[model samples]
Target: MFIELDFQDNGKQSNYQAISTLAQLGYDGVVFSRTINDVITKNDICTFKELDLKELDQNENSSFKNLSSLTLMKNEKKQFRQYSRLNIIISSKKNIFLLKKMENILKTYDIVAVFPQSTEIFEKCIDLPTIDIISFDLSLKYLIKIKYKQVNKAIINGLFFEIRYSSMFKTKQSQARKNTFSNAINVVKYTKGKNLLIASGANDPINLRGPYDVMNMATFFNIPFNQAKNILTANSESVISHGVMRKTYFGVIKVEDKKKIPKELEESTDEDEDEDKNKEEIEIEKEEMMIEKN
Candidate 1:
């Protein structure tokens, strides 16, 4: 499974320490969600094939030139090539100039997806190639509204939810599980497009869930197990593999602390896993009952 780290655009924790931790946690790629403002040190930026959209401006030709310049400057030493993939998220106002700029950006980078938050912008860019709407947490009702409004023309390729905030908001993990299941079901019912991506708005490694756990969550939602696996692994891998970001570590998981899995998640699975376990218990009970009756 291909795991990707959710790094805030502002580069809040964009450091080698942070990247190293994600690499250790089994993230294959890193998606820069917003405009990363801070200048990361050379060592940190070299960690993986990371992405940024700050250069996506309205000037079509200038945008490509600008991307090339940034790539040249940031990866002159080919530090980014060591990682598996590089990607970009494009979203902006729907002005003609901005549209031109977006076209230019698309020409230069292998855009992983276009994240449109505003209705106006989404309308203008929904038909563009390789675009996906970022589904906010448990906002299935909200997405349903959006799908109806867009007449199913919105070319969303995946769904994403914030694990960090949602987990905290629910306080209990079980509640979070229910919310996740409901959200997925809603999106599946409303979505016209086909890919469903599971992501943690992980500013750091702590936010990521293990591949097995993510799959288990999908199983709980009754989402096809393989499809759920794709959300975290294969889908992200495809994005990174074809994206423009240079690979830094390539295949190696950047090991920092040699950390082990936490005891709680290790011992106990989530709601879906528990349900399967319950099914087994019931089957065993039925067999015992048959034996007694006989």
Candidate 2:
């Protein structure tokens, strides 16, 4: 089983800590947060702002060129295809040149770009066969307005009681909340060509629940167990491997002799049998001696 954590909303830990936690959790990879802050400071992309329906460009002086060169050099410092596949989040109104530059960086690591649910932005940029992890955390009533139905996977980010309990239980109105989940599930099930994924939207590792815990939430909302597991496990794996190159990774080899018997108790049956045989022989010899004496 594999889990893909969406860490776009979390900021409590340093970048290294978050990455290390994913490694510890046995998560295949992470969907990293890429807001306006990281790219500008890291010199990944040219900055942009929107005004009156046009995207105004920024100055690309020698400093910008030098920074870009430095970033590329730093990128070259890493081994080719060294890391596992990871996801990067980007919004709709980002600069096109900057977006392309980001794509190049991600391509080195074989990262998947998860775009927002904007038709215009998707059409302009999502040209590569990169995976689309659709966001469905919007209200059930508003989610129906989204135009794209051909996403790679769908994420029910904040569906659990820990996140939605206030809206669900505040006024003792269970039916509406139940209907909302049912509607969302039906949309996911009936969507023409999209896969379903569920996430906790957890800011911390403690908020991440086990498989059975997620199943209980699904059961309470009348969702099937298999469906829940798919969202929680299978779909996440699909998203992680979507854009990455495949490799055959053979693990570390044991230096011990293969033909030797194992030291475990289950493998020690031969010694036990030998001891029993010796006891039986001794008893028979004693009986014969007793008969001779008689």
Candidate 3:
């Protein structure tokens, strides 16, 4: 199944319309991402307002079964799921106070993405475990060359590189597009498309594209066809899984089918047994020594 992990237009469009469009476009799910700064400045109280609306509408319309029969039939063929994500863009030029403020809010979102504006910030982001995705600003003037070591370090820390296609189309300047393409190529080369995520980053309905269209666009960045498919499928799924784990269990989770005692407690119990055995041996030795003295 195909998934779109980043759709930035949740505030602009109704949830019903976006999901309906994605379903028609053959997408199984779409993740809605909003910047923490935007949420704070705009006073955007509800992050998943669209999905909540869909649920409320479904409940209300269920009573009018006959009137909504056609709509229900259309929805039954393709079910589109909605997920919420948060993006945290960082700039090296920012003051230390603001950077600390942003870092404090990292755990509040399902997905925490860092858009590094400089080499220093880029290096720091890769080593951070809370960062789920490293996003590049395709419209920027400077071309930040990605190194293999940094990309590998990011992958090892479970961070995915996010490339937004909408940035390429959003600007009319030729230089911006050229820089975007060049930077993207460098990123793909360094990472070798291992932990890469291709997203539309759609700010409007028109910016949204189907999975095949995105995969075809990946080829333009020199990504192999099979890896392009994985970018939208497996890699995107892995990103979502990591996001969920990060939010639910704080990054690492362990599950056991059988009841297991804590290792620290078991070690303590073993130490107690060892102490008892040592005491018994000492007593026996002392008694033998006493008998020999008698």
Best by TM-score: 3
The list of candidate 1 runs beyond 4 A from truth reads: 9-14, 35-97, 106-121, 130-141, 148-181, 241-294
> TM-score for every candidate vs. truth?
0.48, 0.44, 0.70
The sequence of per-residue lDDT tens digits that candidate 2 reaches over residues 43-120 is 443122111101111323322222332233336662111123233334433432343334544443333344344544
TM-score order of candidates, top first:
3, 1, 2
lDDT of 3 by residue, 146-236 (tens): 6676676577667899888887777688888787787778778888878998888876656678888888888989998888998889988
Report how far off residue 87 is in candidate 3 (Å): 1.5
Off by over 4 Å in 2: 8-98, 108-132, 139-141, 147-194, 219-222, 246-294
lDDT of 2 at 162: 12
- Distance from true location, Cα of 67 in model 1, Å: 32
Q: Across residues 1-294, which tens digit of lDDT does each residue of candidate 1 receive?
A: 355434444343343333444444444445555332111112222233343323332335431333343344345442222222112233434231233323433333333233444555544444333322344445322422344334243422122222222343334566565665676666655552244456655545455566666677667556677776666766665545434321222233333232443343234334764575466556656865897999
Least well predicted 10-residue stretch by lDDT in candidate 2: 48-57
Q: How many Å off is the CA of 31 in candidate 3?
A: 1.1
Q: In model 1, what is the error at residue 140, expressed in angstroms?
A: 8.6
